[model samples]
Target: MEYSFGPLIDENSKILILGSLPGVRSLAEARYYAHPQNKFWKIIYGAWGKTPDADFDARYRFILGHGLALWDVVKCAEREGSADGSIRNETPNDIPALLAAHPNIRRIIFNGGFAFAKYKKYFGAPAIDYRKVLSTSPACAGRDREREEMWMEALGRSL
Candidate 1:
């Protein structure tokens, strides 16, 4: 089983971003979006009007300070390599428990199609509104600029 890291969240978080699962590089590095080509950080930092920090701790602090939280939809899944398409026998994260703990969270954003699908299958639709962005993984084919636009539109000044 491939296990996911604990959520980067706090009681004040107003938005939660969910991924299907961490890629192999991220898991190996014990950091989200660790793959050099992933646009997750770039989009977030850009939307926040800042440059992306190379330091993981600084990035973590930035996320929390901005009232944004990050986690995966899957707690564990059987898969090979880092591709979301390979995931199988997945177990979803305890999202309802998380919502209970952080009642301030008002929006949920799925970072990719896979995350949205898995969330719908396992958790159904949340009472809160949600948005889906194109995957930021290098494996995803969309243009980075368009993805950034979508992210910016969804997150706006909330980040």
Candidate 2:
């Protein structure tokens, strides 16, 4: 299947953001952080004191300004819908491909716990250095705005 949103990557990217899969809004809009309420945009903007408006282009620019790259773990996955539980056996893209392609990547920040849990095998004990694996952002489930802001600050420092 053709990807709705191509990865917004560059050779200068120092931080990689990974998610389990894109949600409906993301797929429909062909952009990452399409869900306005997802807080991904707000968190990133807040870290840099940018206003989180409804404009998608502006948001993407803000992210790119910070040298952040975005992508999902499962590039081609079968899901009844956007629900993570509906995901089935799927083939993920070659993450090492990204790693190799972007030699400047110094940190890998999983957006949520799900992606971390799913890709831990390849990332957990692998020979690849884990020092670049930053903490899971608090924008994910159970974490509130305050926590998310804290994570964003930490992430900014790493980037």
Candidate 3:
């Protein structure tokens, strides 16, 4: 079974960005968006008019410092590869627990359709609205400007 990464959340977090699961490269490196072609860091940092730092430590700080958090909907699963379509026998994360623990989390932005669909399957719709951005995985083919705009719109602020 493939396992997903733990959350990058804390008490200061106000927005939670959820991915379906870490890609193979990210899992290997034990880092979010570790895949070189993934635009997660770029879009996030660009939202604040800052370039992503090469140092993950700085990236982590930047995420939290901006009241952002990250996690995945699937905790573990059997999957042929990084593709969400390949996922099966999945186990979901305790998102309710996380939300309960961090009441400061006021928004959830799914990384793609998979994350949102899985979240609804496991957690149902909540009081907080649903928001989604295009997948940042290189495997997804879409306009980069559209993807970047989606994140900026979903984030809704410098917060």
Candidate 4:
């Protein structure tokens, strides 16, 4: 199946954050970073001095206010369920189209090592030129809040 996603914010965004794919929580909530245990919301709120447990609108506002673009690398891929390893019949998002539309995007940060490892091969750019990937976030794994904060700071700096 060909999985597609709706546009978030706009194409002129300067900073892009890509997750591998939505986990079950996010899919069920119909929201990005919806999992309570996921550090994504807390990290963003902490970075911007907002209440850590803000609602979806509040957090999305913060994301846009910071000129950040959020999305996943694969819109949809077949799988037994949520595990990344189960992903199959792979269909990736058209990143080239995004890049063409968002020339202002100076950096892209993968939300986890999984995304980087999965898509790095498709980058198809010279090793040195691939430095546009500024950093990977730690909120992805749910085990490293400190690392998440560091990457959050790096993401903030990119804006």
lDDT tens string, model 3, 20-127?
A: 989898999999999989999998998889999999989999999999999999999999878999999999999999999999988899999899999999998856
Which prediction has more favorable TM-score, 1 or 4?
Answer: 1
Model 2 regions more than 4 Å off: 1-4, 122-142
Q: What is the C-alpha local distance difference test score of candidate 4?
A: 0.63
- What lDDT is obtained when candidate 2 is compared to the true structure? 0.66
Alpha-carbon lDDT of model 3: 0.90
lDDT of 4 at 87: 71
Worst 10 residues of 4 by lDDT: 126-135
Model 2 TM-score, all chains together? 0.80
Q: For candidate 1, list the clashing residue pairs, or say none.
A: none
Q: Rank the candidates by lDDT, best first.
A: 1, 3, 2, 4
Q: Write the per-residue lDDT of candidate 4 for residues 41-70, one digit (tens) a residue.
A: 666566666665457777776777777778
Q: Per-residue alpha-carbon lDDT of model 1 for 9-45, expressed as tens digits?
A: 9988999999999999999999999998998998888
Question: What are the clashing pairs of model 3?
Answer: none
Give the runs in model 1 whose Cα sits over 4 Å from its true position: 157-159
TM-score, structure 1 vs. true = 0.96
Per-candidate Cα lDDT values, in order, are: 0.91, 0.66, 0.90, 0.63
The candidate maximizing lDDT is: 1
